[model samples]
Target: EKRAFLAQSPQLYKQICALAFEKVFMIVPVFRAEKFDQPTHLNELRQMDIEQAFASDEEVMNALEECLAYILKEVREKCEEELEVLGQRIEIPRLPLRRIPYSKAIEMLREKGEEIEYGEDFSKSQERLLWKIVKEEAFFITQWPEELKAFYAMPYEDNPKLVKAFDLIYRGLEISSGTQRIHDPELLIKRIKEKGLDPKNFEFYIDCFRYGSVEHAGWSIGLERLTMAITGRKNIREVCLFPRDRKRIFP
Candidate 1:
């Protein structure tokens, strides 16, 4: 039998579309092989993705904030009764959500006695603690270390150690992540090699850029996780109709 795998994410497709179409969005199912059996870990979930050519990380972050705020506003106005039934009240977040640098976040965490290291990804508890400090319903953690982000993320021109990336944390959970991609084919290859991945494997992806690619940025939002944030659900499975995780796949 041949080994097969499901689509883990629409990242490649989105980038390709951005190169050709300038802008594109999709709501699709994504699969993950992670073995995490936690309240927020789902093997199969829905993702809402968007990509735009000639855009920066700040531009995409603004778009994401507006998109989320609009959704919450609509829910608050139209789903009042439904929210009442669920004993929840959705708050429309203010525009231009707070942006915190990764370094600053790490410093704040350390001050709060969190023994977290500088290049480490934030744990759920750390995220919650960050929420307590910022006290904002939604915010962006930006400029993550390049080592922690995907190879495609564009490194800062002044400081190559950090990448132009951001993660939107809503109610202490990372609902979306985005970055300005490296449009230069050479840079793409270099980043791939730096990540210990053979550039040959990403030949097709790199080839797309050789034909004159433009700078682009995009993001993906997990539908179930967003639902969990909006509905105040403790578990992501509660928001998913047929949640798939490490266990319980049957109806």
Candidate 2:
């Protein structure tokens, strides 16, 4: 398959399954061919993806926040010796993590002397700055501009230009990203075109919605980035046994 590419995420497939199953989750390795040389960037990585029908972004985010807290508590209590080996200490976040709007985040960043333009994704430095302002190990940034989000992200009701999406930022790193998906076939097509993507190529996915589909939302967690945060590691490669970044391909 000369044209075949590795799976970047289980998002699309999980969304499809959620139509029939109501809720679905998957944990698997994913690949990205992007050229990134950052400490946390990787060409191949693992992720935890979850999808649910009839759920709003807020509902899904609450679930994910609780999940993270539970995992962190367990690791703190159960992996004492292991953490000692790595000289890492994890702080379990409190329930109902703090949430900030993207607009507010931009304002905060600008106040802090960080030059950020609207509708553009935050840079790594900007993420760190916002994390400091929130004063929490984990926080959510919601109401992202629609143009900055994926094609499936549902635009906001009050302002159609912004999407009902949120990013889970942990310890200055983006640990998860998700949104309420556009369920209507017509709306999905419009979003596809808005994102400058071809609906014809996404026909298989689009056709599924034409029959019947429920409002759905989901998020995917970057396994390495999560590990890096939990372990207080500076680089994502440290968490993986065999890392694959912009340069490395083989052991």
Candidate 3:
């Protein structure tokens, strides 16, 4: 029998910690076996992950917005000379950033004459076009289609077809993504089955909720992606000292 190899994401572990700690944050390495090579993608990277118990998606998004704005402000104030050399300007985005629903985003794209479907994920070009249309340096796309998100994402109370999830887009690139996770064990199991996944494999995670659990939402920011956005770098690799992608792995 072939042994399964674990890849790093910190999704499950972070949630587990949130159950006990109420709020937690970590900067950790992540690994993915992505097949495609893109300027913004890497097989291995660092992520800043945060999870908070008794929090809704809206609250989590607000926290992320404030955190990102503070980071940019600090960079702007402390690294003026470095930014000047790079010809980069860090603009602190306004609070409570504009949120465009997934459905509305699809409509906007269609209006712009882009060939796109409602349920499909956005391509890189589509993301850039959306930035152009919105004319915002940073904003959020929220309430994604349920099928497009992970099984752990909480379904919207009003619409089962959608999830309480959001993505932070900066400079036409996704810097972070998050969701209000499903806390009910029954619902989690149901979602797992719906996704054609074996719940047995997730017994450890589900068992944690069986005892007691609170509502929680979390998000992760890709360190390299965030750096690229702040520095106005065209490629994520420009910010990462040792980038690992499909084509290159060695330092």
Off by over 4 Å in 1: 1-3
TM-score of candidate 2 on Cα atoms, chains taken together: 0.96
Model 1 per-residue lDDT tens digits across residues 1-251 = 98877999999879999988999999999999998888988999999999999999999999999999998999899999989999997777888899999999999999999999999999988998998988999999999999999999999999999999999999888999999999999999899999999999778888999999888999999989999989998999889887788887887
Ranking by lDDT: 3, 1, 2
Name the 10 consecutive residues with the lowest summed lDDT in model 3.
1-10
TM-score of 1: 0.97
Look at candidate 1 and tell me the lDDT of residue 234.
Answer: 95
Candidate 2 on 1-251: residue-level lDDT in tens? 47876888887889899999999988999999887799979999999989999999999999899889988999999999989998987888887898899999999999999877988789988898888988899999999988888999999888999999999999999999999999999998999998888999889899999899999999999988998988888888888998988788889
TM-score of each model, paired residue for residue:
0.97, 0.96, 0.97
- What's the number of clashes in each of the models? 0, 0, 0
Task: Give the poorly placed runs of model 2, Cα more than 4 Å off.
Answer: none
Report lDDT (CA) for all predictions. 0.92, 0.90, 0.93
**Stretch of 10 with least lDDT, candidate 2:** 1-10
Residue range 1-251, candidate 3, lDDT tens digits: 98886556999989999999999999998899989788889889999999999999999999999999999999999999999999998888988899999999999999999999989999989988999999998999999999999999999888999999999999888999999999999999999999999999999999999999999999999999989878888888899887889989887
